[model samples]
Target: MSVTGKYGGPLPKGPWAERLHEIFDRLLAAFGPQHWWPGETPFEVCVGAILTQNTNWANVSRAIKNLKEAGLLNPEALFSIPRHVLAEIIRPAGYYNVKSERILTFVAFLMQEFSGDLDAAFSLGLWDLRSRLLSLKGIGPETADSILLYAGGYPIFVVDAYTARILERHGLVGDDVSYDSIQSLFMDNLPSDPALFNEFHALLVALGKGHCRKGRPRCETCPLAGIHLNP
Candidate 1:
């Protein structure tokens, strides 16, 4: 409801901002707080973001727990292991081999660039850090933004299938909407607070899983059920 964010910039007063704010309010009222990212440390959060590429959080949690039990959750310890062994360690997350390579590449990048100091790497400007992360072989936009926002505490919006699905179902976005478009819709229109972005994204995920499910959305019972976006 505030016209400006604590960190970002002045928000334009328009239909998009109002509608997005209303949606965020409704979701927060329905779901309260989601306490998302589900990791104790920034490194763990980054690892979860990568491992969660094609799997659920449950699977990711198992894989992370395995790493923690093995005392290899940090970048250096994880980077030290053989790829096959790393793959075996994260077997529960599905795509173990590919994810292992990705994790190694990320860790390698971290080690080589910052001596495994994530704080140092995150100290760069938003776009600079984003560009560096996107240049990695396995890190895509969503994954990169997840690390930036959730791990680095940057004010960036993260888009996922749940986000796109809910927006499209509510007539806020068209079918086949792009990741960047959805991301820009929120970033451009909303107050650029990491806490708001973080909670809003998490709440959308909750709605997607609980009501606006793919191929079987229970729209009648959804929190955004009666409110239509005036596009």
Candidate 2:
């Protein structure tokens, strides 16, 4: 599963770093800065990260709007609300019943650990915070990393399907790479800055949505079309 090359020689870290930065530059030039994790508060961003799983941002927005309109976006309110009621409110997000449980599970963790204070929760060390987040019922690596980088302002890189597709297409990673391996490619190469990680991930999403489609990628006009492949 290594991305070094077919011959198993160690990949030169310097070139990989430079190429990663080049990809980032190209994406930035094409899409400009993308202020990501679109939410009003840190808590809201965490909620959006949870709700956005297996769904579109538009649906997550509607779900968040419903919560806000119903005065239930607060951790206390969400923690105290009935799961059925919550599910009905967030029905537009798809998998309402499951997502409701997931949100409430996170709310419970927030209340129990940090007394519902997001800043307090984020104040913990990165590994400690991420481990605790992963211990939650439905929060996986991507969701936990999203919460960490976007909501907690941590410097962890968040990898998604778009990121894997882009790297694989550019011969930077194996198609069967694990999540941790894909994530390590960025974390090992890029500077550990929250802003850079945020912008890079968002730009990848933009490219994924706009050009690097699943079935038929618009590679002819993609911003990274002419970029040198790692392999």
Candidate 3:
């Protein structure tokens, strides 16, 4: 809605695009396309977003298979299933009890507010949708952005540990920058392009996993070595 700093100036195009491209090129050269946010449908994307909290894709995949085997991956089915049953099913994903409640809460919100129509839910303006999602329990900044970026195809930059580390090290932002501030740095500077947000976030995640780790960063092999912020 507010297209001020989020979309005003010249977004990352031309030489800026080249910088992004170089980042992507080196990442792709090492890891390939990634074909991220792995899911068959948008519903699955939303579900995966919830299931992936504090877990890896492999565990999330197992949990999803559990839901699929139980025939309750859809909104109605997920909502109707007994909470304990759902928790049991998703046990493999870790934090089963809490995540079960989170999934149900989000699905209930969808059912009540949007009649379970995902497109309708997404039709709300970016800020409105994000605000509404933040009101839900367990839907923190990262989770809300993940749903917006992957599920709704909104051009909202998703920030996580990797993004914070990369940006801070690159001197692009302060160490104490809030989640919204860090995300704003990207959304303000980059074009409001869903594809770019999606790919860039995924690339940052890859970089974090491979190089910018917190405890033991591998700066020697890092592509963004010279770009480190050292703040």
TM value for model 1: 0.95
RMSD of 1: 1.9
Q: Which candidate leads the pack in TM-score?
A: 1
lDDT of 1 by residue, 168-226 (tens): 87778899889999999999898778988898899999999999888898988888988
lDDT of 2 by residue, 1-231 (tens): 112211122233688777876787788888888889899999999999999999999999999999999998889999989999999999999999999999999999999988999999988999999999999999999999999999999989999999999888878888999999988888887777787888889999999999999999998999998878674
**TM-score of every candidate:** 0.95, 0.93, 0.87
Writing each residue's lDDT as its tens digit, candidate 3 over 129-158 gives 999999999999899999998989988889
Give candidates' CA RMSD values in order. 1.9, 6.0, 4.8
lDDT (0 to 1) per candidate: 0.90, 0.89, 0.81
Model 3: pairs clashing at backbone N, Cα or C within 3 Å? 169-228, 169-229, 170-229, 171-229
Candidate 3 displacement at residue 156 in angstroms: 0.6
lDDT of 3: 0.81
Cα-based RMSD of candidate 2: 6.0
- Ranking the candidates on lDDT from highest down gives 1, 2, 3
| TM accuracy, model 3 | 0.87
Give the per-residue Cα lDDT of candidate 2 at 60. 94
